[model samples]
Target: MALTDLYDRASSLLERRFLKNAFLPVAVFPVILSWPILIQSGRLDRLAAWWESLSTAGRIVLGLAYFVVTWFFAAIVASQWRNIIRLFEGYPIERTPLGQRSADWHRRRRTEATQWQHYLEYPDEDEVLPTRLGNILRTAERYPFARYNADTIVIWPRLYHLLPESVQRDVEDRRATLEFLLVTCLFWAAFGVADFIILSVTGAAPWVACLCLLVGAVGATLAYESSLSAAMEYGERIKAGFELHRGQLLAALGLKTPGSLEEEKRMWRAFDKFVRQARPADMEQYRRTSAPPTGGA
Candidate 1:
């Protein structure tokens, strides 16, 4: 395929994936959150009667309006995708008191759990994040650096382009799943809070409001846990992409493929320096006019 066509295909795939991921939270969550208010206010019966009274054409117009509003919200949510991921990843919050305390607590828990040498390895204390989702993804992001001395943040865009279309599809699929789950978790939490507040303000029974809150909390917790598992799968796909296709990446860059593990690590470290600081890493010695062999070392 021509290069421009390939770029267009990738862009189109990404847009579709993003819209799919955005739809549930934008379209479903509002209805879920409004139920308690509707019930508490005794508005559902009135709304149903009103809806039944609408002319067919009026009902069609309302339906169209609902679709347009949901699509608009989805577009806004999709535009803020990076920020949403960061929020789930607990970024700037790490500097806050609550975040610091939570991180320290998690670090201690992991340390205790892994104190025995036979126990499974965990991320280092310094890499621990305030949220479980953040920790799962942080470990994934650090995988290249931890294993190959490659800075994944700097290398991923280049490496992704070099990946096979099948591998790229798998990675994108996993990412979309993770995004969907994270958004669900956030929306469920919002629903629970909104439901509780509406119930209380409308003079609903205290137990009823608490029940709604509990339902929302349970939904959010379940979604969050599912997202953690999704993240693990997504992380593995990413690690595999680097493990299996990194040589292709080097070859595409017109660089000689490293012959040994140590040599590859050294090359990655030097390339990272070059990419991050515009430092001359004497990379010319590694460049080759001929294409390097396919597949990873």
Candidate 2:
């Protein structure tokens, strides 16, 4: 299959499977991670006995829950690992249809709106300070495909891989932080499931089960929110590091970022329109037509 087709299919599959209900998948980890403990403590036998003793209705409910959890685990693990394998094997990270809606809406507004500069890098005198952190987060949230070290790596793999070790390390660290948070959240959720199973097997009151579920829900939310806040704080430094090497980054993508004020202004104007108007399928074409060539690092 073509690179774009592969990218779209991979991206759509990932977003559809994982992004929609990230927290729900956390339910799967309890069974997977607790297996060793269960076996070692002979709790696996006890758990089996408890399951076998349950009423037919209870068995059906528990079976359905486990099925959902296992399916989520299988789907998330397969989709993410496949994407990682594909990307490392030199595949492009193309934009998905969902990712393009924001740009398309912006493009529509640009047609009716007179203030085109608002969309560009240059901010008006009265505008809020467009801090580097704000810009990076906004872009990442609105246009994941446009972020640093994404599809550009596919276009200039040699140059991207040759970037300063420290710069590359910083980028990797940012990615690691996100991955750590995701795993942490998933594990926490799984632990909650374990708690529920233990409580139920030990003949806890129904009200106790309800309380545990509530606490688990709160814990998961807190974990997600806290990690997101921390990541955002660290993302600022990552953004700055990328900005410091903006020239090299653009060069790696075969784009010549403007050095002069006049050139910079012109480039921003063109980029604003390019990002706003280009369709997901037309992204490569836009870059080829608009981005001036740059000397490699």
Candidate 3:
């Protein structure tokens, strides 16, 4: 397989997974800080009772301190959780078919697509192999047999759609991956919240609970990165599959592998139009069904 194909596969699979993995810590950091204070809650309650037995001025001072503490926690959780929820609920991109009509899934897809777009758009000279695979994919879309990567330049005489259905299925399977990730993220968020409650009720300080959650979020990122690196194996495999049979995809788009540059550029313009116009409905569907389940960490 060519380097361009390899990059495409890796780009699509890894970027969203990486971001979903990063979101947890942002949600849990405050909770971790509150633990130290929460640990003193019991003793503080006793102290407050004692103060209540003293003069009214003493009780008033204690009440004011409690208000400050509660307000601080509320402010922290409010601001942090909003960002966490937005990450989970992906805002703007959730409005398109490109996003699977689900925020989590949409953000995952949009991020991957945009990341790949960015990666391919740039060139790397310091690496073992310099790359412009993104442009190559576009070039190939317009001019099928055009081989830009040093590793591979072999192209067959074919259109994309003529390839077997199996290849099409492979490309579409990404949607399933999104679904899996969306559900998994929601589950983990809920688990984190539950763990927080369980530990907090046991007299763990709020900060301690927050720390535990932060650790959990970090663990999730590590696991996702590990899994994604493994999953990237698909990138290599699919590239091979596409090249072995490039006809199907090209035909589906009514594209010849090496179509004219002008035609390829124009087609992309059309694609943009379709994406912009139809995305609102897609976004609406996702908001209804794909918003993270109620009550996440």
Best by lDDT: 1
Residue 42 CA displacement from its true place in model 1, Å? 1.7
Rank by lDDT (best first): 1, 2, 3
Q: Write the per-residue lDDT of candidate 1 for residues 26-85, one digit (tens) a residue.
A: 888877878778887889999999999999999999999999999888988888777888
Tens digits of lDDT, candidate 2, 110-226: 456554333332122222122322222343332212343232222233333555656655655555455445455555665667666766676666665556556666766666666
The lDDT, on a scale of 0 to 1, for candidate 1 is: 0.82
Off by over 4 Å in 3: 1-163, 172-182, 201-215, 224-259, 267-297
| lDDT head-to-head 1 vs 2, winner | 1
List candidate 1 segments past 4 Å from native: 2-12, 113-121, 289-297
lDDT (Cα atoms) of all candidates against the true structure: 0.82, 0.49, 0.42
Lowest-scoring 10 consecutive residues by lDDT in candidate 1? Answer: 114-123
Q: Write one digit per residue (lDDT tens) for candidate 3, span 1-297.
A: 577976786676544433333333334444544444445455556655776688878778866876566556545543443344334333333445543333343234334465464333222211211112222232223222223221222222232234444564554354335333433444445556766776788776678678667765765555444333333333433455545554343334343333555554444344334354653432231122233232210
Ranking according to TM-score, highest score first: 1, 2, 3
